[model samples]
Target: MHAWIIWLPVCEAGRTFGMDSLGGWMFWIVCVCFSVWENAALKVNMRESSLEVVRGDSVILPCSFYTSSRLSTLNIIWTLARSSSPETPIQVIVYDYGQVIEDPSLIGRVAFTGLPLSADIILNYTRLSDAGTYRCMVNNLPEKADPGIGELELSVLEPPSLPDCKWDGDINLGGSVRLSCSVAEGVPTPDIRWEKVNPEEIPLPINMEGDFSGSVQIVNVSSQTSGLYRCSATNIL
Candidate 1:
């Protein structure tokens, strides 16, 4: 029904595609000319960009392209590489072609901004595991072309040491008392747990995200919970 589809079969049915000696040369010439033009255009426009972030904080790396004509193709890639060792240990963080790539480590934490030709990437709830040098590459050229590059740095902070626990005064056998432990800082939000002097003794219900630098808490005092309460924090990183 369509003129182009009907003509395509008719044209291909012929042994020589119904082209004369001169016509065959002209067809190839046209294809070559278009290919050369595309290659030249891509070589003319190329750029680089970058970003940086602290270990606990999140960051967005910008990647974009500049072309003389409106872009019809889009390709973007994000990668992370450790600074140590010489083997170039690189991991693909994201790869996009009209849709975002699904990476298990970055799921629900990565997003793309702006249109296909120009865009910025966002990472959420960063951790020490995310620390590394990153590269963002973009390719939207009509022909095979060099990709645009963007570098990013993620800084991770070590977890702070556990703080000493203290009480106001000595407790009677049946009287209620309170003990506390503190955590200073960490890239990954730390979780607090309480360990008593006696392994068999069960510590009181520990309240987390409590007062004093994300410390752990125990309510309703009892003699069984009175032994040395050790506050421990484990960072997500």
Candidate 2:
């Protein structure tokens, strides 16, 4: 007797495992030896080094500084450098001599929520493109102190909007059956895969008649391919 399996993706976890629409961003800041760079009396106080946020939402990257005495002039600069091209850092915003200069590329998208003495920045309406590393540096020219540089990482995520699995044609022994799966939406890219629940009979994965993802062809079916066929959608945020 020939065998074939049918997979059904009927788990709620697959729908909403890591992402829940209302995303949670874990904000963190990696200290670049604040105590050593600046005077022990004056340093930067960062709350978090990493954060996770949902797409289409605004997140406040928490950051502040500690100062011992007042300074004449302060220079604050915020920069972002994507992993793809780390050498060239994009100047997001800058504050100097009581004057503010925001990069045209991020005119309305970025803002300096905190004062010059204590630097804090807020990113508005973040998307997958905004996911990258951020740096905040302050230079108290009068004090001649080392620049206080803090690093923060941001991750944007979105749940798979629509996921489905369907059979191409009749599932017959010695014939061919194609299963194609796909998802409607996923940020930072979504992964789609096919699986068979029952292990007693396993079918071979072949190149089916589809040029898209979540597509696999099983040729020369035997009694082994008679089980549950399932498709799962998820983003590795």
Best by TM-score: 2
In the range 1-237, model 1's lDDT, one tens digit per residue, is 111111232244455453444566666767776666656533222233334455546776665655544455666677777544325645455444556774676787777766655656677777666667766666655545454665666566666566666655336655545566667665445666676656564544575545434333444557655556666667654
lDDT tens string, model 2, 1-237? 123333333347557434233223211111334444354444565678989889878888776776545655777788888665777888888888788888897778778786755678787887676778888777765354343778899888787767667778667788888888766667656766677867633443534333235677777788877677776667765
TM-score for predicted model 2 compared with the true structure: 0.63
TM-score, per-candidate, Cα-based: 0.44, 0.63
The TM-score of candidate 1 is 0.44
Model 1 steric clash pairs? 55-155
lDDT of 2 at 153: 90
User: How much lDDT does each candidate structure score?
Assistant: 0.57, 0.68
**Any runs in candidate 2 off by more than 4 Å, and if so which?**
1-42, 161-173, 182-212, 221-230, 235-237
* Model 2: per-residue Cα lDDT at residue 166: 76
Question: Candidate 1's C-alpha lDDT?
Answer: 0.57
